[model samples]
Target: MDVRTAQKLVMENKHAKGFNVTDVPLEVCLLQGEIAEFFTAWRTSEGDAAEELADVALYVLGLAGILNIDLAEQMEQKISKNAARVYERGANGVMYKTTPEQTSAEH
Candidate 1:
Protein backbone atom coordinates (compact mmCIF):
# COMPACT_ATOMS: atom_id res chain seq x y z
CA MET A 1 0.00 0.00 0.00
CA ASP A 2 1.24 3.47 1.01
CA VAL A 3 4.26 4.48 3.06
CA ARG A 4 2.11 5.40 6.08
CA THR A 5 0.56 1.95 6.17
CA ALA A 6 3.94 0.31 5.79
CA GLN A 7 5.27 2.56 8.57
CA LYS A 8 2.48 1.52 10.88
CA LEU A 9 3.13 -2.15 10.19
CA VAL A 10 6.84 -1.70 10.77
CA MET A 11 6.29 -0.01 14.12
CA GLU A 12 3.78 -2.66 15.12
CA ASN A 13 6.28 -5.38 14.31
CA LYS A 14 8.99 -3.56 16.22
CA HIS A 15 6.69 -3.19 19.19
CA ALA A 16 5.80 -6.86 19.10
CA LYS A 17 9.50 -7.71 19.06
CA GLY A 18 10.21 -5.37 21.97
CA PHE A 19 12.57 -3.17 19.99
CA ASN A 20 13.71 0.29 21.11
CA VAL A 21 10.59 2.29 20.37
CA THR A 22 11.78 5.75 21.44
CA ASP A 23 15.51 5.42 20.75
CA VAL A 24 16.01 7.55 17.67
CA PRO A 25 19.82 7.37 17.77
CA LEU A 26 19.86 3.58 17.98
CA GLU A 27 17.31 3.38 15.19
CA VAL A 28 19.40 5.65 13.02
CA CYS A 29 22.44 3.44 13.56
CA LEU A 30 20.43 0.31 12.77
CA LEU A 31 19.15 1.97 9.58
CA GLN A 32 22.74 2.71 8.57
CA GLY A 33 23.71 -0.92 9.24
CA GLU A 34 20.85 -2.09 7.04
CA ILE A 35 22.07 0.14 4.23
CA ALA A 36 25.57 -1.34 4.56
CA GLU A 37 24.12 -4.83 4.51
CA PHE A 38 22.17 -4.01 1.37
CA PHE A 39 25.29 -2.62 -0.31
CA THR A 40 27.29 -5.74 0.53
CA ALA A 41 24.53 -8.02 -0.73
CA TRP A 42 24.26 -5.95 -3.90
CA ARG A 43 27.99 -6.28 -4.57
CA THR A 44 28.20 -9.97 -3.75
CA SER A 45 24.91 -11.49 -4.90
CA GLU A 46 21.79 -10.09 -6.51
CA GLY A 47 19.38 -12.61 -5.00
CA ASP A 48 20.01 -11.65 -1.38
CA ALA A 49 20.26 -8.02 -2.33
CA ALA A 50 16.50 -7.65 -2.63
CA GLU A 51 16.01 -8.93 0.93
CA GLU A 52 18.65 -6.58 2.25
CA LEU A 53 17.07 -3.70 0.42
CA ALA A 54 13.75 -4.57 2.01
CA ASP A 55 15.45 -4.45 5.38
CA VAL A 56 16.75 -1.01 4.59
CA ALA A 57 13.30 0.25 3.58
CA LEU A 58 11.79 -1.34 6.66
CA TYR A 59 14.17 0.50 8.95
CA VAL A 60 13.51 3.74 7.08
CA LEU A 61 9.76 3.37 7.43
CA GLY A 62 10.14 2.40 11.07
CA LEU A 63 12.21 5.48 11.75
CA ALA A 64 9.67 7.66 9.99
CA GLY A 65 6.93 6.15 12.08
CA ILE A 66 8.88 6.72 15.30
CA LEU A 67 9.49 10.35 14.41
CA ASN A 68 5.86 10.84 13.33
CA ILE A 69 6.94 12.12 9.95
CA ASP A 70 4.58 12.13 6.99
CA LEU A 71 7.12 10.51 4.72
CA ALA A 72 4.78 10.09 1.76
CA GLU A 73 3.69 13.70 1.91
CA GLN A 74 7.22 14.90 2.45
CA MET A 75 8.47 12.81 -0.44
CA GLU A 76 5.79 14.20 -2.72
CA GLN A 77 6.58 17.79 -1.72
CA LYS A 78 10.31 17.19 -2.11
CA ILE A 79 9.82 15.68 -5.55
CA SER A 80 7.71 18.63 -6.65
CA LYS A 81 10.25 21.11 -5.25
CA ASN A 82 13.08 19.24 -6.96
CA ALA A 83 11.20 19.20 -10.23
CA ALA A 84 11.07 23.00 -10.22
CA ARG A 85 14.74 23.32 -9.22
CA VAL A 86 17.93 23.86 -11.19
CA TYR A 87 21.17 22.01 -10.62
CA GLU A 88 24.74 22.94 -11.48
CA ARG A 89 28.15 21.42 -10.86
CA GLY A 90 30.04 23.36 -8.22
CA ALA A 91 33.80 23.83 -7.81
CA ASN A 92 33.90 20.67 -5.71
CA GLY A 93 32.55 18.65 -8.68
CA VAL A 94 29.24 18.06 -6.95
CA MET A 95 25.82 18.92 -8.28
CA TYR A 96 24.12 21.51 -6.11
CA LYS A 97 20.54 22.69 -6.24
CA THR A 98 20.48 26.43 -6.64
CA THR A 99 17.78 28.58 -5.13
CA PRO A 100 15.74 31.04 -7.17
CA GLU A 101 17.77 33.95 -5.80
CA GLN A 102 21.02 32.26 -6.88
CA THR A 103 19.64 31.63 -10.35
CA SER A 104 18.70 35.30 -10.70
CA ALA A 105 22.07 36.46 -9.37
CA GLU A 106 23.92 34.23 -11.84
CA HIS A 107 22.05 35.70 -14.80
Candidate 2:
Protein backbone atom coordinates (compact mmCIF):
# COMPACT_ATOMS: atom_id res chain seq x y z
CA MET A 1 0.00 0.00 0.00
CA ASP A 2 0.99 3.61 -0.47
CA VAL A 3 2.14 5.79 2.39
CA ARG A 4 -1.12 7.72 2.51
CA THR A 5 -3.13 4.50 2.54
CA ALA A 6 -0.95 3.10 5.30
CA GLN A 7 -1.38 6.32 7.27
CA LYS A 8 -5.15 6.11 6.91
CA LEU A 9 -5.18 2.51 8.09
CA VAL A 10 -2.97 3.34 11.08
CA MET A 11 -5.15 6.30 12.02
CA GLU A 12 -8.22 4.13 11.85
CA ASN A 13 -6.60 1.43 13.92
CA LYS A 14 -5.53 3.95 16.56
CA HIS A 15 -9.03 5.39 16.78
CA ALA A 16 -10.49 1.92 16.99
CA LYS A 17 -8.32 1.36 20.04
CA GLY A 18 -9.49 4.68 21.52
CA PHE A 19 -6.04 6.16 21.14
CA ASN A 20 -5.33 9.56 19.73
CA VAL A 21 -2.05 10.86 18.40
CA THR A 22 -2.85 14.43 19.35
CA ASP A 23 -0.07 14.57 21.93
CA VAL A 24 3.01 14.95 19.78
CA PRO A 25 5.44 14.32 22.64
CA LEU A 26 3.68 11.14 23.67
CA GLU A 27 3.52 9.97 20.09
CA VAL A 28 7.25 10.60 19.72
CA CYS A 29 7.95 8.63 22.88
CA LEU A 30 5.78 5.79 21.67
CA LEU A 31 7.61 5.78 18.36
CA GLN A 32 10.92 5.63 20.18
CA GLY A 33 9.65 2.73 22.25
CA GLU A 34 8.62 0.88 19.10
CA ILE A 35 12.11 1.41 17.69
CA ALA A 36 13.60 -0.08 20.84
CA GLU A 37 11.32 -3.06 20.49
CA PHE A 38 12.49 -3.52 16.91
CA PHE A 39 16.12 -3.55 18.01
CA THR A 40 15.39 -5.97 20.80
CA ALA A 41 13.62 -8.27 18.40
CA TRP A 42 16.61 -8.11 16.09
CA ARG A 43 19.13 -8.75 18.85
CA THR A 44 17.24 -11.76 20.11
CA SER A 45 16.75 -13.25 16.65
CA GLU A 46 13.00 -13.05 17.05
CA GLY A 47 10.98 -14.24 14.09
CA ASP A 48 8.60 -11.37 14.79
CA ALA A 49 11.26 -8.77 14.05
CA ALA A 50 9.48 -7.84 10.83
CA GLU A 51 6.27 -7.26 12.78
CA GLU A 52 8.14 -5.10 15.27
CA LEU A 53 9.58 -3.07 12.43
CA ALA A 54 6.08 -2.70 11.00
CA ASP A 55 4.94 -1.39 14.37
CA VAL A 56 7.59 1.29 14.20
CA ALA A 57 6.51 2.26 10.70
CA LEU A 58 2.85 2.31 11.71
CA TYR A 59 3.52 4.58 14.67
CA VAL A 60 5.64 6.88 12.52
CA LEU A 61 3.03 7.02 9.76
CA GLY A 62 0.27 7.54 12.27
CA LEU A 63 2.14 10.40 13.89
CA ALA A 64 2.80 11.98 10.52
CA GLY A 65 -0.85 11.62 9.63
CA ILE A 66 -1.86 13.26 12.91
CA LEU A 67 0.50 16.15 12.20
CA ASN A 68 -0.50 16.42 8.51
CA ILE A 69 3.06 15.83 7.38
CA ASP A 70 3.85 14.21 4.05
CA LEU A 71 6.36 11.74 5.40
CA ALA A 72 6.87 10.01 2.05
CA GLU A 73 7.84 13.25 0.36
CA GLN A 74 10.13 14.18 3.20
CA MET A 75 11.66 10.72 3.03
CA GLU A 76 12.26 11.11 -0.67
CA GLN A 77 13.92 14.45 -0.11
CA LYS A 78 16.07 12.99 2.63
CA ILE A 79 17.05 10.06 0.42
CA SER A 80 18.05 12.46 -2.34
CA LYS A 81 20.16 14.45 0.10
CA ASN A 82 21.80 11.28 1.41
CA ALA A 83 22.54 10.19 -2.14
CA ALA A 84 24.59 13.38 -2.63
CA ARG A 85 26.31 13.23 0.75
CA VAL A 86 30.04 12.56 1.15
CA TYR A 87 30.43 10.52 4.30
CA GLU A 88 32.98 8.34 6.01
CA ARG A 89 32.34 5.31 8.16
CA GLY A 90 34.27 5.43 11.40
CA ALA A 91 35.80 2.53 13.30
CA ASN A 92 32.80 2.74 15.65
CA GLY A 93 30.58 1.91 12.64
CA VAL A 94 29.03 5.34 12.57
CA MET A 95 28.70 7.31 9.36
CA TYR A 96 29.86 10.91 9.53
CA LYS A 97 29.32 13.54 6.91
CA THR A 98 32.47 15.09 5.55
CA THR A 99 33.25 18.21 3.61
CA PRO A 100 34.63 17.98 0.07
CA GLU A 101 38.00 19.15 1.34
CA GLN A 102 38.00 16.51 4.07
CA THR A 103 37.09 13.83 1.51
CA SER A 104 39.87 14.89 -0.80
CA ALA A 105 42.34 15.07 2.07
CA GLU A 106 41.43 11.52 3.10
CA HIS A 107 42.23 10.32 -0.39
lDDT of each: 0.88, 0.87
Measured on C-alpha atoms, candidate 2 has an lDDT of 0.87
Would you give me the overall lDDT of model 1?
0.88
Worst 10 residues of 1 by lDDT: 98-107
Question: Which has the greatest TM-score?
Answer: 1
lDDT of 1 by residue, 1-107 (tens): 98888988999999999987899999999999999999988997855998999999999998898898988899897788788888999999999978663345664
Q: List clashing residue pairs in candidate 2.
A: none
Task: Give lDDT: candidate 1, residue 62.
Answer: 86
Model 2: what TM-score?
0.76
* Candidate maximizing lDDT: 1
Error of 1 at 24 (Å): 0.6
Clashing pairs in 1: none
The digit string of per-residue lDDT tens for model 2 on 3-99 reads 8788888889888998976899999999999999999999999758899999999989999988989888998977876787899999999989885
Off by over 4 Å in 1: 89-94, 101-107
Per-residue lDDT, model 2, residue 19, is 94
